[model samples]
Target chain A: MSERAQQLLEIADDELLLGWRNSEWTGIAPFLEEDVAFSSIAQNEIGHARALYELAGRDLGKTADELAFDRAPEEYRSAALVEPRFVPDWARTIARHYLYETADQIRIEALKASDDAEVAGLAAKIDREEVYHRMHAEMWLERLVGEPRVREALVELWPKALGVLGDDLRPLLRERLAALDLPEVEPVERGKHSGELAELWEKMTVVRRSVPGATW
Target chain B: MSAQEQAFLEYVQGGGQVETSDWMPAEYRARLIKFIEMHGNSELMGVLPEREWILRAPTLQRKLALTAKVQDEVGHAQLIYRVVEDLGKPRAACLQDLIDGKSKFHNVFHYPTKSWGDVGVIAWLVDAAAIISQKALLKCSYAPYARIMKKICWEESFHILHGRDVILTMMNGTDEQRTLVQEALDRWWGPLMQFHGNPIAQGDDPSFSWRIKSQSNDEARQQFLDGYVPQIWELGLTVPDPKLRKDEEADRWEYSEPDWAELKHVVTGNGPRTKGRLQLRRTSRAETDWVRRALLAEAA
Candidate 1:
């Protein structure tokens, strides 16, 4: 794959997996209003992934859905941060939400400076939606920052959150964490698939794989 | 009825609407709460069956669409629970009653969704059935619910289109895919027929007398048949009912008597999947109790 295509897939895979993880809270969020609000955020992530895949598909000669779903779990370039399930655990979920959006802002800002106009344009579009996601996460963080469980969740997931961006972006993520009084931790790098991603892949592709070569 | 209560009934019957500040007869308010609360409960419980498909939707488009559809149901539940809340019962109490099995949702939600075909059938036909009843509520005497139904019905139209798209694509594919739709339709037909509840004359039903529902149980069922059966048959899908037919002479549909017994059994919380779904709700609620507390404390 071209370097640009590979880079696109990496970000697309992250959004796809993160959206899938977040959507698990659709029906069962702590409250109804939050449930609706959170699901919209999940949909926005998937939408961003689809647009990224479509751009990458041009280089790879594949459809967006093919790039998104047809790959083996091992081939996925998503970071470990998004692979874990967080349902029924609002504290951890919000921790991941706040951290991922923070890290993602750094990644997206760099992409917005890409030489390729298509990539830069898409990055701009995604950042616009991410504005709401950031506000949502920050709102929750403000509300629950004093709670012990929220603090513990942030501390535990800090390393994985840093892993979402590259070394160049990690410094920026650290700067944001410092602003929030979050402690810095060692990074858990990507390039490895967790068992949880495998399980998620199984459920995600079950119906599509049931009858191969047939349109859903 | 007391003279005052009779006048209230007459007012509602004469196209009058009630707001939160209006004075209503105690019985009307109580029944209205129960009825509307059940609608809210159904919208919430309805999410369970569909959310399973959100994770399993066959393609990225399917996945996103299914997730949004489920999200809309949750949104509807929120809107409905707000209406219920204004009517006196709080949202938490309604949710508590639902988990306790002391309240009822619609019967269709109690059954299991066994396949992707079930997803299409539900999004297509199940939602189609619901839209019929909801459209009647467009004239609901409670103006708040009536207004919300307008939005709900608009969203439901998109769901039906999405569902039809799913079913049609499958039906146009391999024989195995067609079999999936047929099998799902067969299993769901009975519940769909029973969905609007047992037949009752419009004038005799209290909900009708108060203008909460402008249509009777059978009228809604007939409308569902009139609208959907032709579409189903045009696609070469069987109705799964040997006796289902419209009698043009009477302008009504006649079919095998729906298993009223099963409808009763299910809505009373004895369907095949009722216990498990409710238990899932209970467990999730308990797990998230602390989050609510933190929010309340922050607000205070």
Candidate 2:
């Protein structure tokens, strides 16, 4: 209901959806060590969502679970960028992963300075953990940079990656991308849901919706 | 078989620890891979039975814990496969062998999990059986596998605690919840009994001969009983075995014989849920194949 609550919800929704999408690779990632490391990142994303939901829930009169699983598909405030189930496609997954972490880093930096101290504090903590994600993503990005498939995938997904960061942060994101030697591309932008979100929401909410009144 | 191998064999028989680059006969290397590969397969296959539960977990805590648990299984698989890799087999080859069903995993993982109760019982009892063997592996001659076992055993300690907490909560809940736990135990009893494998003599088992398994099959089963049976009894849940008892003089557990033929059938990939579970793994891997090829240096 409050502006702060809405802001938290959108960010939380993005994280929850992205976390859900990323976890699809839990058992099937390319390598075992990376699989473990990546799964931890996915869990942490969901964790961030939960903590954000908890903060947002206090004002909305809802629990974190209610906020996470109780929402209808269209009611979700996640960006389209974080919604796809790109399980088996390492190229697209990494492109999206590299892009999202970049966008998230930019956004979290802004959140870290929010007027709500708790919001700012939590964002700061999350940003610290994202450092590893960035390292891991960048590691893959560097390795794949010389490869044609990864480069092509990056070019194709750049616009959507740009869309993840809001207009206010575009200049800074662009500046950062340039510093990293990445070429310019249009962003897919926030506020729109990708086709992937609907399917993800369906599976995610299925169990929680079943026997709704009973505690698991 | 040779005079040198005979001496090497006697050393392991006397509790000698063998490192990776240490002197070993060809037989020891083959036996090591067989035992450890099965373990790696067990961890990888183990993920399937519990993964669906992550989707169905009732609460955020439950979802997170279950997901982490399953994730840990994948991690364990990775860790295990690395050890196997060091033992002269490539990970890809090991995976190839696994999907082909040319190797075996533990029996408990082959059966279907019926309810949330099954999940708890598995995390509790199955992991308990595994930990008994794993703790023994902490002293294994294979340094790499044994080193990894320390981490595996430490992490498993948490899994068992989480499992015990889950079981206790269900048991202390409503009648329906209690029934869920009891029903799950009944269905799982046979598999749990067969978990440590048939009580083969340590001397006759090559795994034991190489000091790869410090405890005998029967010894591991008895330890599981000794550690967990009382805990089960205190919770007021029946183990479904009428002859289940501990002999004070022999210090051995006596229970009705587990269906060895059934254990053989299930582990060889013919349990009721084996094909379906393996099918899921096959499909998911196929679906995710591009990711590996795209990212892995060697695969690329």
Q: Each predicted complex: what DockQ? A: 0.89, 0.43
lDDT of 1 by residue, A60-178 (tens): 99999998889899999988899999898899999999999999999999999999999999999999999999999999998998989889999889988888988888888887788
Alpha-carbon lDDT, every model: 0.93, 0.83
Judged by TM-score, which candidate is best?
1
lDDT of 2 at B64: 78
Q: DockQ (C-alpha) of model 2?
A: 0.43
Interface RMSD, in order shown: 0.7, 2.7
* Per-candidate clashes, comma-separated: 0, 8
At residue B161, give the lDDT of candidate 1.
94
Q: Write the per-residue lDDT of candidate 2 for residues B1-300, one digit (tens) a residue.
A: 899999988887776777888888988899898889999999998988887676557667777787799888988988898888888998888888878778888888888887889989989989998999999999887778889999999989989988998899878766777888999999998998888889787778888878887888888888999999999999999989999998989988899999999999999889888888777767767766755665566454
Write down the worst ten-residue block by lDDT for model 2 chain B: B291-300
At residue B175, candidate 1 shows an lDDT of: 89
